[model samples]
Target: METPIDRIKLSQTAKDQLLKLRRNTKIDQWNILCRWAFCRSLAEPTSPSPVPIPQDSNVEMTWRVFGGEMSDIFLLALKQRCYNDGFPTDKETLATQFRLHLHRGIGYLAGDPNIKKIEDLVELATKKI
Candidate 1:
């Protein structure tokens, strides 16, 4: 099977943010932190900005590690979002959108001041951002 995403490479700023998130939320795993970041971006009502983030950090993970057991569901959701956004579900589009949304989400999650505890993650699902 074609990998949903070959690898995820965070910008230096994003890597720094993820480190802060790890300390704040006490989640040691990069994949789990990234999952939170990805979902946070998806929860936004607006489409993510398409700025090209420089992949200048060493943080890289395969799609399998990032998605864990829900990888298939995550891929379907990504494809659905692409179709909704009038983008094709082609490989390049998927990869690009994944990076955009993931980075955007990471920024959002890291910047929120209320997310200092693991239980605060429920806010991502319940609170009206």
Candidate 2:
């Protein structure tokens, strides 16, 4: 499956949040944390806000790195989300939605007071959506 985005660049605010998450969860790899964040956003019932997210931070990763072994699954999930939200599956729309969901998830994870360790992340993942 082809992904709409080739490269992923995060906002400065997201970078700071991920830094904190790393210190708290001890998950050093950006891609792993990103996968968690992306899924976290996907689990939400509401659509992500459409506000523009500035990619001013230096943190960057290829789509391959971000999705790792589950690239196709992530792409399918994004496509499914777009379908569920009554959005077009065009590259532009997919790309925009991907960014929104990713950033929103990061914010959710960072803001959650319960996410202080890796086990907390696991608990969250195991919870019913």
Candidate 3:
């Protein structure tokens, strides 16, 4: 089993932007984008695939594709922190902390706002291909 679709997929706006770029450049758009992309999974893995998290039982999946997981690490850290804290009050400080974690979480919530400065860099790396 996979996590719920919690993040955003590439938006139509981004597609429009890409279309504009392709038109302006008068080029085969996919060619340029493909060169820089690093795809994670084009579909769900087969029966013997590594579990995304240890909590999940062995399972097989079948899907066409999904977004990258740049933010997963940071989100995990945030989860760890939250679990350790035993559900602290939802304060601004806590928000800030989570924000920091999300920054590093690559598109952690798919189109979610990045918490760290690095997200922008990653965004550029994946931008829209």
Candidate 4:
């Protein structure tokens, strides 16, 4: 069966941000870093901007790699998030929300100063942004 989320690509800014996050967290895989970014963005209370992010960077990954073993769960959560945000859960909307959340999460990881270690990600659970 075809994956619901086919491919993920970052913008130039997000890619740069992910580079910083990779250095800080020492998690080398793009998919792993992206997973952190995805969940980080989801934990936030505000919805991501609906503005479309340009897919201008070279970084790319298949949905399976990005979501790994929990691919279905991640896709379902994303679709659910779209529904919760009062948006349609159609393919286009799902893809857009996924990109929006991914970029926003990357920004969250890159912009934080205290995220130098992997353990610091746990702080996201307790700290208010």
Quick one: best lDDT, which candidate? 2
User: What tens digits encode model 4's per-residue C-alpha lDDT throughout 17-87?
Assistant: 98898888888999998998899898877899878799899999999999889898898888778888898
Q: State, as a TM-score between 0 and 1, how close model 4 is to the true structure.
A: 0.91
3 versus 4: better lDDT goes to = 4
Q: What are the TM-scores, per candidate, against the unseen true structure?
A: 0.94, 0.98, 0.21, 0.91
> Model 4: how far is 24 from its true place, Å?
0.8
Better of 1 and 2 by lDDT: 2
Model 3 lDDT, residue 100, Cα: 31
Candidate 2 local lDDT, 1-129, one digit each (tens) = 788999999999999999999999999999899999999999999999899999999999999999989999999999999999999999999999999999999999999999999999999999875
**Considering summed lDDT, which 10 consecutive residues are worst modelled in model 1?**
120-129
RMSD of each: 1.4, 0.7, 15.1, 1.9
Name model 3 segments beyond 4 Å from true: 1-8, 34-129
Residue 38, model 2, lDDT: 97
In candidate 4, position 87 carries an lDDT of 89
Off by over 4 Å in 1: none
Supply the global lDDT for candidate 3.
0.32
The per-residue C-alpha lDDT of model 2 at residue 66 equals 95
lDDT of 1: 0.88
On TM-score, the leading prediction is 2
lDDT of each: 0.88, 0.96, 0.32, 0.86
